[model samples]
Target chain A: MAMLDVTPQANGTAPQAARKPRSHARMAWTAFMAILRRDIVVTARDFIPFLLQVLVQPLFFLFIFGKVLPNLANSGTSSGFGNTFTVLLLPGIVALTSFTTALQGVTLPLVLDLGFAREIDDRLQSPLPVSLVAVEKVVFAAMRGIIGGTVIFPLAYLILGNSFQVRTDAIPQLIGTLVLVAMAGATVGLTIGTLVKPEQISLLFALILTPLLFTGCTYYNWSGLSSIKWFQIVTLFNPLTYGSEGLRKFMMPPITVTTPAGPQSFTIPTLDAQWIFLGLGVAIVAFFLIGLQTFRRRVVS
Target chain B: MAQLTDNAIEVIDLVKHYPKAPVNAVDGVSFTARRGEIFGLLGPNGAGKTTTIGVLTTSVVPTSGKALIMGHDVTADPIGTKQLIAIVPQQSNLDRSLRARDILTFHAAYHGVPRRERNARADALLAEMGLADRAKEKLTRYSGGMGQRLMIARALMHSPAVLFLDEPTNNLDPQSRLFLWERIQQMNREGLTILLTTHDMLEADQLCQRIAIMDHGKVLALDTPDELKKIIPGGTSLELRVALPQPALVSATGTAREESGLLTALRALPGADKVDEIAADPNDPAQEGITRYRLYGQDAGTLTAPALQAVSANGGELRDLHLARPSLEDVFIYLTGRNLR
Candidate 1:
């Protein structure tokens, strides 16, 4: 028979004689989920900022380009043929909305907190690997990206009216496009967050984000750059172009065309849809790797 | 890798030097903490105590040395080593955005505490640390004491083999400091190894089983409280208060002197044990003329009746009598000619 040793208890409750060992596997799951849950909950703390970031900008773009720009173009034309403007602007609006939402949701806060406020130190100390913490941030950004993109959809649909085809068959492709686009955007945001110091963050806004907005294939398609060969060559360096072009292929496949009349047509031509999607995927993975490595280095060293 | 021992902590010449600083922050500091012991690392500000704790907790890597917790090298296997240790930073790093209870639960989950067990542990720690009432409140609403308590509870989430506290009560009020000490003592009683750093001599005296005083990035002294006090040659030099602080015709009994007041220093008299009661100043020192003797004794009670009579005969008023014993401060002065605090 095994003998049991007795230890005195501070409380009145007698020792239970048997204590259970902890399950580390279960704890890992709890840790990951807890981070995700906490991040989600705290995002609600700044409700107005969240709304402005996720809904306001997308709405502004949709109303301006989706509704106003096309209307303005139609009024100038006696025939009132501005319906194609809606088709062209809707996909770009979706891509732009997701990009902005993802960038703000993950990048700015991550860089500031990890660099100056040091709010992320608590999470880093958790039993979870540091990479999981970074992943949680990206995951939260992805969720917000989906929300921002979806918010613009109904408004764009109302503006596009019957001319905007739902293309139910393209739903799967659209969802796939959104996921890839969000990943690419968020990963790029993470890369930016890692590269910029706390003081240099505003410089990133002026220099990096501005360029991203212009060249991210939001207002125009890759094929549209044919008129300016140099501009097309420069845009090849912008990862956002691949994401926006891939999204256009998914949301408005019929719009993927080129008149070849203007030196730079305002439509996507010569750019292969499959290649754009692959490039976006590749850029997303590469940025994630670099960002994660940078994050790990910052946390450890 | 080394075999695990009953000692939860073993540090061998742990050294850490920052690139920006000219000297090493922690230099060749080595110590061991047995299981269930409250070991203390004491030093003045910038004395390398926090840096040493950082190395042990795997937060900052050591420059050239190694620290092992439960047989895991802190540098080579930080994840495995961190699994057995938790650190309470000098500054509060609790997520201000998180509710107090969620803070506890989140820390638990991060340490791989099981989901079902996490809530129970969180509740128990909160209640034990007197934080249960405020557990639902956000951290931004917590006071200094409450934040420190929450940090302590956070460290307990994993039930780590060794808990490292870096100045756990630095800015806390006295009452909160006492409360935290009691909880830490309770934790130690349950067979958990605790390593703490502080410059408060009184705290170290009360809680540490063994202490190491560090200064200028080096260990000045390391010993049990009683043994450390022995470093002072003639125990404590008492300063007795009489109506007249200035003694007339100061005389030396044994190896002691009447420095000030009715205070007389006796080198090695009898009946000067630690439990001996110390008398107060005379009621009317100016009128009745109070006389006090400053008794200086070695090994606690080196002054006694003979020395007292001699002081009384030597124009000293016997208004109040008092005996002082060597404190950790005296040991600090003996080692570095300065107080530990």
Candidate 2:
């Protein structure tokens, strides 16, 4: 065979004296940013579909529970229960949209990336630790969740006018809750995304997602679940319940209901603001670690 | 470490056995490629070529033993190994949503190329791969060959020290394959060490400076193409096609059977070493009544005259005759007892 007579120098050249090897932290950060940028660009190019996916469920919930049900109830007794239900349901919609969107954003892409497409192979070749690729996916998905939640917020007021109320005094806490809830959404997405096979995706939605949404305090506040003691305990295992309750506590005003004995007032269960924030923080770390470990195992092997 | 400075890749006793697999996919394989040479792993499917590349490229950790790329142990310092090498995988794994140019640019950025240099390098690579026209088009819009060229461009975005091309020309049309071959040769000329895996014997013969022929998870033979060809029984072969249905037995006194008569005459030639009947094409109906014979010898010219004389004496008409030098395919068959393809 013909041989090339290019530079016959071996090892190409000596490592440049002026160029120091990058610290591990720097390399990891660069890889993270590059992957994040690529994913964002891809997502932006498909923005219309992404926006539709994020908005569809929240809009559907707002139109049905926030607008239709309340109108249907008002036509009967002018009970004001319709208005109160709308206020309570608004926060749940935001939380549910954020969590489910985040989960789908991570899981579906991951399934495709790891299975037929193998697009993640490109990112796996990066100089960063293999686990960091999983973390990057989680981080980006969380950002999408936050974006989805932000977009859904205004539509609630537009569709359920004069029904939804924002507790201005709790605005600071609300913003914090939103951020924590978004992170939790992403963390759960990462964990489930890494655990699932492409073939099991349909089962994921059927078995896992459907249950999480219904029992996740999306329809009723956790405080109201006290009547069904077993359900209250079981729903506590769902991370979305914390986010939903947290959003309700910060986003809505107290609702008064008349009992047979007398008129009484109750608010959506707080589950305590401290515990909600703490649970979200812990879940974020725990799920992230698990996802990272699983991702590294899958990619390396 | 010292060997690593001179060699772009080194594998020592590398083995990889998937969980529950009955046998190792890459079993105890070892080879080394110099910094400027194009080394090939030529083998049939399931011959462990891709698995070996996977181990050297740090994608699959070995079950035992070690592999190093540019002096960094792959298992101990995979990031360092990855930094020194890039792989053009057998399949098109490029992001379908991204445009051709963005794929290169993003890959460069991931490898730590400066932003300004990333765009410039990506453009240069796109132009080099003949993909400048499609730079702005999404990969989903690219034809198979175009997607392949784009993948080659992406793999070179970072200008890695060593490039691993796994079946790079598998599904290309003739023109695309030739284009890629010329491009690969040009890259090697510019001093990039390449490790290629292909089941194409002709491809290995034309492009590789040295090749390791593997089969059934083991290296059957490793040498330059000419040297490998020399490993077969004889350096040349004379093939004769004759009319069939002649007598099977041969007598020494000219009343011999046609088949034995021809064999005796050819074996009595000056340079004839071995003689055998060539199998007819099973799918060709015309092949049923025709007899083909191959005479392996040191020189085809020396055996030609006697081979022709034998056919004439036996009253068998010689329809066609061809002489060929031993090729890599022949050598592969000799070593593995099966055709390479």
Candidate 3:
């Protein structure tokens, strides 16, 4: 019984015609592109809901902090900090929105994919290595971050009007920061998705991410914590802090406000771009490796 | 022309002992499924059928030994082997976000089928699976049967050399089961080497050219359905129920088969080769004093009259007498002494 030598195909018409042989690299690349394309098509069909999902929180924050609070603060003793606050807040909002958008982009879909039904099997069946599938998730999520970041600019302008100033120089540095921040956000999202139980997702936000976002230095410059030296060091633990500081380094210009007294400089200090990129690069690599390990355990078993 | 090795799947002493498992899930299982034949792994749940399919599909790594698909080692060359095989797993793993047409097309794309060829094949498979009209429908709207057909269509997208169906019709209605059975036969006829796992004895009997009957992580019997039935001394059996000689008034219900000597007499009959005295279930009071014995022979017809004569000669009253054609179920019971799992 171990040896079956019967020629069952002797007279059987070959079910498949001979396929053209493809190189291993070519097949893997094709499968990767297919998964990416499928994700894009799915996202495009529900683009409005997607936009609502990632944009709602950031937009609400932008309106409340960038417009309402600063205006209210102007009527109070903290008068000078209003417009200067919104100016620095613009770049920080861009950073956090991009980071959180990318994070949610990967984590939400992965909850369904790795749930009991394991819908991920549909793609895992493809002729690609296990790690490549996780890579695809990160790549697609990064694209969403880029889109969220781009869309935030126009929306921020509408909220702050002339207060949203950008000396949009260091074009290459800005681009690099955008890519690095998006990648960091996505890899962290991947890690959470694979490691946490689906039911723990909501709790993860309420506990881990919300507090992290609050301390990420998105509403204020990282250097503004010089008075609270402990928080100055503590905020660095948040990956979103590096992203916010990185975007601020390249995007924010020194604020100049002309008042009844005279023109005054409103200084909002930012961390150096070099240090921010270094921290972000390390986090992305570390989370990517961790995500890959967790993803393989959850999928292949 | 010299014949190349045409076995589509070769599993050699494959074993998978999951970490912390008390026993190996698949213990030294080995079999070669010849090309274009419908081969079956018939076993109950937890009998290692799914694990074996996992090993073959490269989803479950073996703890020891090896499995190959068309000579590509599963562990060493999963990508290459995966290119030649497609699996329809027990659970529905369909991408619920995509339309049925997109599901097929995306599957083709994943297999590296070129863009021009993808749509054509997807449409063709949909039409063949009787899902052409609902090609644009969302998966949420699909019935279980329709979804199963869609899975079948998706698996065929790559025109794979080997197709693995892990309990293919597990939860489908009978109508769907029959439809899928016909589809499997058609695919096998057209020269696709098909390996399916099913606990359905009728399914194995009706569909497979050969079957491996597994129990407790081992293949207990492996042969064609007819050949397996021949494991019992009779391809047919005389299923006889007879009342035994009266015991003492105090011991009336129990010990009587030894007193009657009918078991030995039945075994000594002209055509009968084997006899088993079935112990009446003590838990069931309905079978109180009657003893049942099965007389197995090459031809059960020849044993009926002689068995009745022997019973009468032994002063035992015949209760029921019928010739039973042995089934794979009987063979399983004969081999394992347990039914189902």
Candidate 4:
């Protein structure tokens, strides 16, 4: 064994074989990162103006819901009547902000580039499979989503000032919720981005997205819609509802209701958090796969 | 891993049929392109030029037959085929949001260029295409010619084995066209195989080492420009411009007779050979209002210079005279009986 293995040439060949596969994997990772970098750079270049617009919108919403609505509702005192408006709307703002940021990640520019500009053609022709490009889009959207969420959360807090009560211990849960919410929006964005022609993008926002946003559970909790069973069931079809509900559960006070099951609940109990995370994870993964496939076909065809 | 070889492109009877069409869009077109040749697929509109290129580039599937790049069948090994080729479509498809150089770098990285090499390659390609000055400008700011140049640079960034240019300068101005053609020629000469398609026959004549002219999904002719020109009905085409009218007047210097200013061909002459025509100009060449005639001879040299000297010496002004060899257009008309347009 010693004589056979002693040769430098034999030892070199053995390592080379092992090294090839590992290096190949590394090379693939590098390609993936290049795609990610390209997206982020483009996103960042436009990030300044986009962030200005994004920050303004959330700030406006914060002013409206956090300051104006509470003041108008509680006679400028906002302290009385439970001052829960801030906490109630915090999660909604989070979802809305993330959703808006995620929407751009896959909207007019993406659609125009796919259908008209054909910029995606370059990416599709890459040695990496088309699915990787699609995934990178989601990753870019997720990064922007997290950034939007992080930016809006503290601002929402600073503006609300004691009106909102976000449980400190549930920070991990909030992070998980934001991640999933961003993913859901990004996937829907990718799917819709591929579906709509560039000329029809305005109609997409006017018709589909506007209606979804209006009916989404952005203003109220799933538990609050007790009387409207059918409406609640219908809302379940929307990923936004789940996003908002999961987010609210992590932010607002735990609302308990007495039902036939006695003390039925919507909150993800500490011990059962994994189930919520799992559900969110599954939804993200499923939408991602569907979006990935749709994007690939759209690019190829 | 599939390996790239000397023949950059090999298509064998490639056919592509759309869903509702009664016939294939591309019907049984075949050709082999060497590794570093500038090959042109010349054809009229709807001649399956785009369809054939789309199939070869993997943008569309062939209904039947096979196209291989670097020895890998496009249908069987799409990713490998794609990795070795880049297609610059007839349309401008630049990423408007990105800076000019980013297009090249992004494309290079997409083809698996490492991060360390991407920037340098992108810069080199842009510089090679004379686009370094505008590298930081977004595509939205670039003009059509700059955009087209950038597209070429992007395609070459990965140093693809073959580059497919589908009408690379279709809508460009004359200056831009000449610029791009020179760059394209340089690229081919630098050892990159180029497969270009264009309806402009002159471009094909000037640039292509070999060209295939197609029409209605059929290969009308395939050869060098000179060879294709020889296929025209007449061995040589002679366009003689006479300032007069439809045809030039012809009379023998010594023995011909003219009645009412009409010169008679007067058959086999002693001093000259068979002169075919004397009529008004088919295409009026000048404002002289003078009538002209055309001549056809098995040997034009037998009578051309002598006839011109004789006409000038005989007090008739030889206002306009031109002789040209047949062009690819002549061959195209001879073969297809129509203009490519």
Candidate 5:
């Protein structure tokens, strides 16, 4: 018979002197930072593709609607329409850029990680609560959203030369609105990323994203929608509408037009800055809690 | 200072049931591995070996029961338990986007290895696993064997007290398998306790200090390989090939000549305890005019003469004879009434 000879060795090797266990707070912090840094490095290495994903659609929108259409229709400084349209379109592009970049950042990789690739298993095994992994993903997505906004802001100006302007007085509001919008983008990304199945991802573009873009107050302001009563009520539920309106109020120049009734000024109606900030803060907390719960359940089970 | 425990792993009646599955993946399984020993859980696929490892590693939660790693309950203190052990899962779960060196470095960082030592340890581990040359390559470009080696290197980043390998050699070539085996043995000698799961009996025999044979979600047997092999009916076997004519008649000496008569005579021989006729294919050309018999007992040499004579007297021509030692495969067949793989 083929014999298996395995003699048990003495357990006599002196165990290394036991060291004090690190405090839970310190360990958790270390693990969290490590995960965050890894994600940032991976994103940085593949930056070109990431940059392209963030810039492509916004660039096309700025070129076509903000520049080409206005010039082609012969509506420029002479008609006062070209500059008005550019002011309206620039903020919309920034909001859309932040929204889509954050959404794709979290959802695309999440679907792949949770589905066939299972690359997330390594992160799941870290010595931290599983919920923290989901939070780290949100943090990274939010950072990407902010980066997307910064990249697109300069590109918007390049595309709509001399049409778009940033008022020095509104700079603080612009910065605050951008930060809140990025946070909202990340929280929404986290929720949708965890809730949707890989197979159902295409449906997200059709059912969720299409509606968000059309009703998102990108081409029109919330006050302009008041002329259409039902739409004014309906668009309130779309989170992107608030983001677009907030950017419009903070980043664009005031619209002035030449009319039969002398020089008339039109200001797009927007929610109070306090209300926008409050709404975004509430959304961030709500989606984060929901995403964390769903992520924890999926990972543990 | 806390004292070290002798047992590296202790699983107690662990059970894991998928929410909608008909049966438990792991059903009331229990075992222990002493510190500094390489223990194996041997089973065919779907025999709960991976599930057992999953629960012990805290990747999969158990429905009930408890598992302790290095004296910390996995459920009660999962992070503490996770800090104490590392696993090389069966699948290639490494981040494909990261370079080979980055994979190891990231693992070390996650496990709280000091930042100053992380790069040096990653280089040393890659070198030890024979992967230093390819350390800068992306994981997407790695071969299956290379990926498996990287996984092993990554798992050792923390210098874990216990290491779990779930079918580490599943798809490895012979040379790679042997290399991995040697590396595993070296790690064990250096005082790392290992718990590995594999269906290959020979692998378990070669690497395990003790094994728990599992089947159908439960452990069927647990012992050293030598002792498990001894559980078979007899330690040795005698195989005999006899040529017989169609519509066979009695032997030339006029004694009984059927398969039953031959089996009885073989059993009556000294040192022969159990005798059986092995079934053969009726359509096989090589076996068309032959009969095969197997006798299980202590010594085949002593029974060789009488066995051949018995066949000849029964009007059958003695074609071939051989004595063989029973293997772990035979023992598994005897225990489960099925093949191990």
Candidate 6:
């Protein structure tokens, strides 16, 4: 033989075998990464269309509502409310786009795999736990969310000109919030994917994702909705509301307004940083548990 | 010759009933395959063969009863059981997202196949399946037969101790069916235990070393094909429907066709076993308004001529006649199921 060949042998051990936990862990990790590799290859194959999908909606929203409409409101003038409006709009738009990417990335394929194609059967048949299979999906979707969130920053700077107010000091906070928000969004997708029936998948996206974007405080800030008291409270229940607010908490400059007592920078307003983290934390835990349960139900039975 | 080891699959008193369903899908079905045996579950539609295979492959949970794959309980240690078995489903469940090459590679990865050896094993299996030339093509480009071949190759990627083929030849052409049959036999010869489900009588008889004939969610008979044939009153089955000149339903003597001694006439002949009258399907336009009877015989080739003469001698007109070989269907009908309506 020209080269040495390693045989294709499987470690046919019992799952309940307590003697070899180390080998079992390695096998589980190997299977998990294999599924991840497959997902990456498949996603990368459609990279262009996916990239365009994530960018197009937010790009247009930033352009039309933040750029064109503000300029028109300011009577076609250059320097006015456009700057403030873009700064306020940028965080929400980015949150909306990235979260929506995570949600759809997990939900659409999950519905198809469970409902029509039955491709998930292969993973269920793999030498790993079914719950781990579901977790891998959320993990991959969250990764996309992080990427989608990061890719928007340069675009925001380009469109908003000098109006972009990303505080350089808050880089760590921004990275942390970005990852957490992505995880929250991906978990929500996992929940929706498992809950929705394949036949009603079209209705599922329209009923869930659309309402999420509209009511998620994506188009407006939660603090700005003072007049609508009930609506503000309701938006607090929405996870994406926290995502937008969290990004704003980290990225935007901390409460600065001109007051009678010199320049005031003391009070952080009603949308507290602590509450945003709490809401996202709850979403990640609650949705993942629910999604994992339903996913096991659908696959095993 | 391959060494026959301990049981590769052991399913006992298995029962699976969907919620609110009138009957159990798999009712008290029990069987075991010794290592390296080419075992089969042969049945008509709704026989619960698929469900039985489903439980074994970890895709379905049993309502009750125990199933062990190589002494590992499927429900308790499913991951352990999964490491031992792989199923080629009845439906096209291959990853449509990947090419043939990626599908094989991904499946190898899923089973924890070594990274370095993944491509080599996949390449060898593809070449064995005669699909190496088209490994880069999209799955949609492959024909039904080629897709099935790829699935079989993928199932073997892990070199599972037991492989499941759920109606592997269901929609395949004759040439492809023969090709797959040969492949299945080759795999079995290499010391890989195989379990397959099918409704085709000829398939079960030809391929399976030991067959379990199932119907109505139960295994009606299980044995080697020859032994199963020997257990029947006669090995060959002769089924024929006769249309009388008058109203056949005039008397419900269970059937008007049985009022004559045509049943006795056929049973009296040499090479003939007891004759049973099966109610003709009311929905079948060709066989409607007539009474059908099945005559089990030692040799259908010898009994066919005399049996046709006997039908005519009893003043009955033979509308249609079918001589089924000593296959799974003969064992199926002999063990008592609804007529092949």
Q: Which candidate leads the pack in lDDT?
A: 3
Candidate 2: where is the Cα deviation over 4 Å?
A: A1-20, A256-265, B1-4, B238-295, B299-322
TM-score of each: 0.78, 0.87, 0.87, 0.79, 0.85, 0.89
Tell me the tens digit of each residue's lDDT in model 5 across A207-300.
Answer: 9778878887887777877779999888877777788888887876667778778888867567777767776778778888988887777777
Error of 6 at A223 (Å): 1.9
- CA lDDT, every prediction? 0.71, 0.81, 0.83, 0.70, 0.80, 0.81
Binned by DockQ into CAPRI classes (incorrect, acceptable, medium, high), candidate 3 is acceptable
lDDT of 1 by residue, A1-301 (tens): 0111111322211221123434545545666787887877788777668766677776777677767777788787633235555666677878888877887778888878777777787777765667888888888888888777777778667756665644466788788878777877788888788778889888988998999888776888778778998887788777777767767776663432233453232333435767887788788889999989988877765
Worst 10 residues of 1 chain A by lDDT: A1-10
Interface RMSD, Å, model 6: 6.1
How well is each residue in B228-289 modelled by candidate 3, as lDDT tens digits? 98899858888788877676464744445444477778878888877777667677788777
Task: Give the per-residue Cα lDDT of candidate 5 at B238.
Answer: 77
Winner of 5 and 6 under lDDT: 6
DockQ of each: 0.19, 0.30, 0.31, 0.19, 0.27, 0.37
* Residue-level lDDT tens digits of model 1 in B1-341: 35447777888988888889899998888888887789988888899988887777666778888788877777786666666777788777788778899888877666655677778777776777677788899877788888888887787776677788888888989888877787777778776778999888888999999998888888888889898887766676553434333434453442133433223333334544222113333453454434333444453343445655555554454555555677776566556654454
Docking class of 4: incorrect
* Cα RMSD (angstroms) for every candidate in the order listed: 8.6, 5.5, 6.0, 10.2, 6.5, 4.8
Clashing pairs in model 2, backbone N/Cα/C closer than 3 A: B249-B257, B250-B257, B251-B256
Which lDDT tens digits does candidate 6 get at residues B1-341? Answer: 11143998999999999889999999999999988899999888888998999899887999999998888888898887787788898888889889998899899888887677678878877777778799998887789999998898888777788899999999999989988898887778767889999888788889999999888899888899988888766566788888755544465664544545777787788877667777667777876657777777777667788988988887789888888755556567667745532
Give the Cα error of residue B277 in candidate 6, in Å.
3.5
Q: Which pairs of residues have clashing backbones in candidate 6? A: none
Taking all chains together, the TM-score of candidate 1 against the true structure is 0.78
Residue lDDT tens for model 6, A1-301: 1111222332222222222333556777888999998889888999998789889887888788877888786685543455556666788887887798898889988998998899788887888888999999999999999889888999877886756667788789889988988998899999999888889977886888778888888777788899999999889888999999888777766545454666556322337888988999999999999999999888887
